[model samples]
Target: MDFETEQATRYQRIIDLLSPPDGTPTSTAKLEGELEGESDDIHEAITDLIAFGELELVNSSQHGRVRLHQPTPSTKAQATLTDPTEYVWHAYITERDGLGRTRARRLFKDREVAEEHLKQIVNVETLTPVPGIKKVWCASLGSKGYTPEYAVLRREPVFQQADDPYPESR
Candidate 1:
């Protein structure tokens, strides 16, 4: 990705991680650790977000803390697009039914839980094509009142072991 796109992605990730409904303040150090991003890049993103009024710097005992709250009244009109509750985690699976494939989805309040479920599905080993199992993944879904958006968080092919008992190359 180009520099601008990469920076924007990092900024979005920072916002998502910090903007829980409770309006909790997160330490800059913790955000850096979570994002596994360079200190300079993370700080730059934080600065840009602060300027945008999507985040507020907190004067906490520990240095470098920020909290996500309603932006200034001037920016309130734009809040819906950046609201904490706007995005929700969704876990989805596609499977073969009697004649065609069916898709199933589960909603999660926590991103970590959805990710764990995705991992479980992808890590399972099947000797044969498991009867209806097709594909599984987890993503974040944007709520209504605007264009629906989805961000695929995690996905991987299900692990399978070769079922051939006799070796062809032996």
Candidate 2:
């Protein structure tokens, strides 16, 4: 996970620990030991949570006693703390030469995004500057354990100079 996600998830954990009747005011030293982080980082997280209105310091002079101020965090805050979903869907846009050999391929996480990219390539909506783009297509891929299977979702002819260009050349 990236730093932001990691930090937010940690913040969520803190909220869960200190929110409600189950939780009581805890010292900063005890929280740092529980979290297993540098004193500075723990202090920073505590300060941030306090500013976010999820936590409050019970003793300003002690600067170590803290408790949850809000039982529930906002939806936006929860969203930042949510774990990223695994991507099972894979889409691709491929470029082929006259010899029916793949010249290039690009992967996308979404099918529609891949199809839109393929459309741009086929229509010359974007300048590729490729000399001979005989065919282009969008393909969906699936994986089962170690094996991968591909199925073409969309195909379009591009600069087709010949119906069969050097058919036996390969």
Candidate 3:
């Protein structure tokens, strides 16, 4: 399948996994396990949905797989789309490069703070220096707005930037 088609499928898979009704089933562990087998593209999709305020991250493996919390004034909810997608992506970028793995629990810990950062950066897509990688390095703000949001993430850059411009195969 093509890129867009593949993305649609990935989104559906995650949605179906998290479709459990209110209070009846709140376990998101199984869903997480299933995606654990997915390719990197799906991983980035998950990150995108989570960042777009459509999915929630969980702590205990037995917690809600993902949630579609209703937006409310009380939930600190806001319209995420009117804002720039690139700005949100940049929230994931490090202050400085040349780093190893580091987990930031509550990855979007400061959603509003990150959104502010998003608005500041003029070109968020420029943050991604590697090829064939999802432009998820910078994206929108908010966790799709789950109460006590739990849209956690565990992403690692699979592609590294080359010092030279030519491809290794070429």
**Candidate 3, run of 10 with poorest lDDT:** 94-103
Per-residue alpha-carbon lDDT of model 2 for 122-164, expressed as tens digits? 4322322111111222232223553222222322112212222
Off by over 4 Å in 1: 1-3, 37-40, 60-62, 72-170
- Candidate 3's residue-wise lDDT over 52-124, tens digit each? 3445543335343445332221112223223323222224322111111112323343445544444454223
lDDT of model 2 at residue 128? 24
Q: Give the TM-score of candidate 1.
A: 0.38
Candidate 1: 10-residue stretch with minimal lDDT: 126-135
Tell me the deviation in Å of residue 52 in model 1: 1.0
Task: Give TM-scores for every candidate, taking all chains together and pairing residue i with residue i.
Answer: 0.38, 0.36, 0.34
Clashing pairs in 1: none
Model 1 per-residue lDDT tens digits across residues 72-160: 21232333244423445545432211111113345666767766665565442221211111222222233455432222232221213
Better of 1 and 2 by lDDT: 1
RMSD of each: 21.7, 24.7, 17.3
Task: List the candidate numbers ranked by TM-score, top first.
Answer: 1, 2, 3
Which candidate number would show the highest TM-score if scored against the true structure?
Answer: 1
Each candidate: what lDDT? Answer: 0.45, 0.42, 0.38
